[model samples]
Target: MRFPFFKQERRVEERPRDFRVISPRIIDILTHLKVQAEKLKRTYHRLLARDKELFEACVRAEQELDRDRATIYANEIAQLRKMSRTILKSQISLEKVIL
Candidate 1:
């Protein structure tokens, strides 16, 4: 009285997943990432040192520029004083000649 369509089919057995195959590959990737991270950290520190050195150089250059500007201004002032003295001596001689 039962039909074949009413009977349950047998289920296929699934194989257990093997993590050993994937675990080593993941470990290798993690190890590579760690090595790369260390290298990047070293590079960043080197860059920082270079930046500090450049800043110090800029400070030295600025100091030199200030000294040069002061020297130029002092020379110009001396020249102006000499010119003023010459004019006063000429004026005094002219007054004596007229009198």
Candidate 2:
């Protein structure tokens, strides 16, 4: 449909697409991730040590028939395992960031 009162205009030029460089922000994010990864690693190691002690204590509790104590240690071990998995995931993400 054409309107008698409207004018038809033609574009004479095309605008180029704008490109942006974001290396600095990326570097800052990677640096922060590196620090977080290190902290996660430290936490992982500490958890492992604590888990080992918990296992040993659980074993002693079992031998003594201390059901409640054994159950408590078992729960802690499960929590430690869950935390370890998160640390591993963070490490993998850190590797991806480096690449």
Candidates in order have lDDT scores of 0.58, 0.87
User: For model 2, what is the C-alpha lDDT against the true structure?
Assistant: 0.87
In candidate 1, where is summed lDDT lowest over 10 consecutive residues? 90-99
Q: Per-residue lDDT tens digits of candidate 2, residues 34-53? A: 88878888888998899899
Candidate 1 structure quality by residue, lDDT tens digits, 1-99: 768789776899998998666687777876766665555455545545554554555556557786665555555545545554554565455444433
Cα RMSD of all models vs. native, in order, equals 33.0, 6.2
Residue 45 shift from truth in candidate 2, angstroms: 0.7
User: Which residue pairs collide, candidate 1?
Assistant: none
Q: Going through the candidates in order, what is the number of backbone clashes in each?
A: 0, 0
What is candidate 1's TM-score against the reference? 0.45
Which residue pairs clash within candidate 2?
Answer: none
Best-performing candidate as measured by lDDT: 2
Each model's TM-score, in the order given? 0.45, 0.68
